[model samples]
Target: MTQHTPHLWSRLRYRFDILMAHGTPVLIGWLTAVCLAIVVPASVVLVGASRDVPTTAAGWGAAVWRSVGQTLRLGGEVGSPVYVMMSVLLALVALLFVSALVSLITTGLHHRLLALRSGRSPVLEERHTVLLGWTDQVFPVITELVAANADRRRATVAVFADRDKVGMETEITSRVGGTGATRVVCRSGSTTDPTLLSVVSPHTAKAVLVLPPEDPGGDAHVVKTLLALRATGPETRDCVVVAAVRDARNHPAAALAAGPHGHVLSVDDVVARLLVQTSRQPGLSLVHQELLDFAGDEFYVVPVPALTGRTFGEALGAFATSSVVGLRRDGGGMVLNPPSDTRVGPADRFVVITEDDGTAVLADTPPAVDEDAIVTARPRTQAAERLLLLGWNRRAPLIVEQLASYVPSGSTLDVVTLADAAAVRGACRPGRLDVRFLRGDTTDRGRLAELDVPSYDRVLVIGDRGHAVGPDAEPERAADDRTLVTLLHLRDIEQSAGRELFVITEMTDDRNRLLAPVREGADFIVSDRLVSLLMTQISENRHLAALYDELFAAEGSEVHLKPAADYVVTDRPVSFATVVESARRRHECAIGYRLHAGAATGPAHGVRINPDKREPVRFGDRDTVIVIAED
Candidate 1:
């Protein structure tokens, strides 16, 4: 119904328009050349005309006839061929110069096209490792990595995060700059993408440590990354992929995702077990540091000589430089502070502490027993300990598994939940742990009071990952609030009962830890933050494990609170230096001490571990000695 008007420009003109839009510089160059050509020719012609040189053939014909006539009078036409040859040579030289310039532009485009085909962009060439997560623990992790990699050939680390990469880079550089490092590089890309992952070559990488995404229900990203790598096929199978997970329930899926050689670690059980070790014996992390690190000294599991058969106590001092800690018997069994009577057979291997196994100091002489000391240090009996678990999450099951090894028979666990969900993670059972489920609001004072809280020895506040708590809320904040509220109610109970409670809870926020008060014994496990910190430290200084062992060993070497009555008189205020001098005599490292005033009710009347010697040991009618013991 309408009459169509034709387009002012045709299809070819539209195509030209698009090309001109993109090649404005080229278009400008061509136009400039055309303008110069026209201007030069017109100016020369006009100037010549002004000087009375004709512009047409008629003038040329007249000029030729006149030149002939003039030649007769003078002489000039004979050398005109020379002028023509000179002009041709000059024109050829000009053409060659212009060709070279055009070649330069074409060559630039060729190189760019080649780069596109090959799939790479030229970038910074500094020797900096890259990190790819945004987290509170990132600063510490970078700090430790800087220290670990200080001896690298170059400086600088690159970080790619979910947040602005440049922003993360700037903030980290400003905050952790002073920690010895070369530099930090940042770029934006989702770490899960293979195209993005290629920016940091997994094949030629020094190391790759993946952290759990900030809000993933505990290491979901870590698991996904592992699966991504595994699915990448066999080429990258050998690459070392270290990932930290929060829940053991996800371990199987994570393991399946990790494939054959990758290492998937559950931070929950690892930290929980470590805290539990530190609780029973504080300073466990230090011992692990000593053993895990390459510097100072470390623990190595070495197979013994075929002829080496000696009792455990007798072989304690066998190694010239290494100190024997325990034996890893058979394949799966281990005896950490075995009885002196326990024999180290020819097939048995020893877990000994040394600077390095490559330069091992094997004992040349036969070892003998220090029977009296070993016998005196043997545990009197396996005492029953109480454990209380509040809330639920992925790590709940692993805690139950590791507890079986440390908690003695008859031990009890009271698991308190909201709506009191009754569910256990895969391949798990509470019966083995003597765990009893008490469905109630743990934070409620009356309800918490009704449960006989004072009877429990240890309270573990786990974060709830239930339906009431949205999956998107900050896990750490949610867990922390629950812990604070529960602690308040526990404090009230303790106020009336005048009984000390030992509480160890998980913390998501390292900064928010000061908000809660633990009138009873309490320790917070900031597992995720520390995992990255330890990884970076180990990456740079491989020798840190030696320090770890000295702090975490359960038997023989442990932080303990014993009766000072055995080592020092209570009425005296002995200086810490003097006590250290005394304890060092027995091969123990003295760090700090606890007071006996809190422990006098039971067999352990009052005992503080690593006490300051100057503190009056007024042997409270109820105190004992707190110390580290290398049994």
Candidate 2:
């Protein structure tokens, strides 16, 4: 029995340790047990020592109750010195145990609060938006989401990224300002970790937007994040997921990782295409901004039962406030700028551009068309022209490709960049354009003068990313400042030549656009802002994915700024209904017209979209009409 005593004590000690490790509640239970052990035995001893203790069970219970009061220091009966000294000792023991219990509860509560602030707790929200990853695009995306939720009573946007939870919240609050009625919750952790990604509860979210990081390997990380999101559960498969890739090569991989219901886009391709289109056509950026942002007019797919069996041409003037841009066939295909005589099926939906979903109401009667004011003049034939490109970056090659596909054969393009001439030539192979590269600094006035800036039909200044910066410096600002200096030199040259140049400047930040030199017929393309707008739009409505895909592609119908004279008599005051009718005759849809007088003005910048059809206006020879057409 003595030999086994040590083994038995060891086992009991192990069990006691296990019990104590159960946290505050277990410690409290043990404290109560210890208190009862001392109090009850002391009560029995005091009752037995009492001089006049009764022999009955009731008298013995009364005596023990008096001892309990003494132990708690509530009161004490007149007893001998031995009982009094023992009661004092019990009170001291009670004080020690009670103090430990309070301390445990306080420390436990503090630890739980810290855990919550660390973004380790799971979010319990339904139908919220989940944003993964972080970039400069988060500001605009969050701002637009707030605007999108203006009609709802309550909405939430939960953010999960590998950043400080408090820091993320502070930056968003500073940049986005007040988000009334919309709760923004941020979680910090590595997005690639599946365990961390589950904290935001992506399964219950209505939509998930994966923002591409600014690093070189952002696309790979985005793909991993998408796979991680999928690994969360099958419920996330039904939620709308959208992402963008910086390189075209990663688009297929990203789409596959995003699953069947997810949508992925190539940001480089979209920005490249916009650079090519906007360089030739000024004020087009304003039109795109109107369509992309939620604060202004946007595209909506609405079911128009009134025009189910009507022709596409007849539906152009059906809405007095909205413009019909395309049709979504009931079977599944999208036909944009289709033939005027194309019939709308019963289940087909009209793709209209309007301010709100309920504002696409059909008119009681078709607006009066000014037949006499309509012109039958043909559009000008394509002519070979000289084009000049300033600056260079990773997107330069894609921009060259898009320009080559759109320009006529034999058109000459001269590139003045700081990049290696041989490398530029190797990447930018000509399709229909005669591409030339000149190694020069675009910001130098003497270098820009050597190119004969006024001789080119259009000038493009792309943001350069080759500038060196410190580890703590902002990379985009250095490039944007360089672009601004180049623009200032170009504006000076234009002043000396007495001719306004159609300059298209590419900027990385939307705030820097306001700092760029103001020039007539000039436009700025904030690449990050546009991509954020696209992702937000798709997340809100998944059907727009295909619509925008068709709109941005080279082989499909695209937005064009054509001469207003091609559609209607430019000198006469005619209603917008007349322009719509004239465009329908030429197998096109006229959304709005740009006025040359207002081109340099504030606010609209000469661009008007989805205007009232009954308002009459006169156009000049230089004025252009915004339309969706197939070239």
Candidate 3:
């Protein structure tokens, strides 16, 4: 029923706790001094007040001073029992107190070191590239950025993720090998945390890559990261924010959060469109890779004063080394493979594919056209074809929809999957395609054999997205494994039948693409890698987005590998200029050629883009010419 006031010592202890909680050096020093003041004097007094001590004040004072000196040195004379006992007691007390202080200091220092290693410290960098979030795509993104800045003396790429800084660095180094002149810095932090985001100095960064996390709700995480980036401040508002979202539904919200400077790439939609496009054209993936990756010829926007009054067609032949693919309007927007008659304005810039920006220069005189070799021919007519689709994923529906627009009316497509046939059937349009669903494991040799693999003109193997969701399975790795199994079975089937069957396989990870078996008639589409490449390309030059959209669309001009016999006399030596002249007569642009014999090999396969027109090359009957034409 009655309340008692707090004790003085208890109050002092509470105040000391408050000081320790503040974690300031000044308060810590004060606490240490207070501890020594109380402990040292108390130990000395207890020693002087012992049972056989002197009675005079001066004697007691002298004895206490001697005990203090002995305790400080942790040693004393052994002859006097009282002095010896007091010295031992004082020494024990002193050792205990000093140990406690040392322990406290050590623990505090350890925590501070942990914080520093965990990337709590702010990064001081300018004009760097900031990568927020971590996924399988980060490796490829870093590799591309390294190649993008290969010409620079030094470049920095700061990565902020909810992961261990050392672990991230180790993994990147192991996977990427070397970053050349680009220095990659990793910071452990949450992508959605604004304060943690500041560790990468986003305001001073030239660009930011918001990679979607490897989780079920990746789009949600991407959207949150975009919101955090948008909230950074006005200084970062104009900085390019390139993010990839897995779901189309979150695109609008992500875009709104990203504001005007952000470019949100829909991974699912982009992969689906690419699959649909590549399914019909076997070697198209190689063209996209060459254009997207920095290791080979890539797109470059260069201004040419001489091309001001020239038409798009006229400008095409102006570059001997570079291949003019499109033009960027003076005001805005990009038109890829535009109409031949489209006139280039004074302020227009040519978007050409070249090994480097400097190589995009226009030649003083265009290569001489071979009039005798120019054989004009009509575009090939559409014909009904059979397609076999193995496996299924979220992109299956979108791929079917896009494929429906490209195939002929009577074309038939058979989809084989372990998923529900009705669900797969629902995603397809019966009006455009004669759709049939077969329930089976696409990786099983028996199931693949039942589908008559050799009968289908083209076979597409879709990576299993569901396998990655299983317990103890990595999404990208699992999907890639399934894809690899299916590809191996398809290849065996082709080899046993002694027939060449066109195959396009989807891979979730770029690394797995390298592990895929080398088959003469197969093409691999690494979904994540391609998306990463496109994101990087667009991030570097936003105008390329329009060009990519047009290239992947069902309509418009697309790159194709046509038979060499269709344009030139096979086995006859002719310059690439003759092939270009021949393609121009048909209202199509001939960028390069594909050698059928080398099509299955690695690196360039048989695809050659932007070759020197003056060089004399011989084409076999089986070889194909690479051109951009509307079907």
TM-scores of all predicted structures:
0.57, 0.84, 0.81
- lDDT of each model, Cα atoms only? 0.57, 0.86, 0.81
Candidate structures ordered by lDDT, highest first:
2, 3, 1
Clashes of 3: 0
TM-score top scorer: 2
Tell me how many residue pairs clash in candidate 1. Answer: 60
Worst 10 residues of 2 by lDDT: 467-476
* Predicted structure 1, TM vs. truth: 0.57
Residue 604 C-alpha lDDT in model 3: 84
Q: Write the per-residue lDDT of candidate 2 for residues 1-631, one digit (tens) a residue.
A: 4564458889999999998889998898899799889998999997898798779996787678678876766355536767766866677677778889999999999999888778778899999999999999999999999999998999999999998888899999999999998999999899999988999999899999999987778899999999998998884555899999887879999999999999998988898888888876778788888889999788888999989889999999888889998998987677888889999999999988899988999988878898999888674678998999897777788899989888888899998877777777888875889999888898899999988899999999987667321111236677799899999999899999999888888887899888888664468789889999999999988889998887888888888888888888877788999899888888888898898898778778788988888889899998888899887
Q: For residues 489-571, could you state the per-residue lDDT of candidate 1 as single tens digits?
A: 87788778998776666667666556776532345666765576555543443333333334344434554555444444456
TM match of model 3 to true structure: 0.81
Instruction: Report how far residue 548 has shifted in candidate 2, in Å.
Output: 1.1
Off by over 4 Å in 1: 1-129, 150-156, 174-177, 217-220, 227-239, 256-261, 275-375, 383-386, 424-433, 467-474, 492-496, 519-521, 537-631
Instruction: For model 2, state the Cα shift of residue 603 in Å.
Output: 2.2
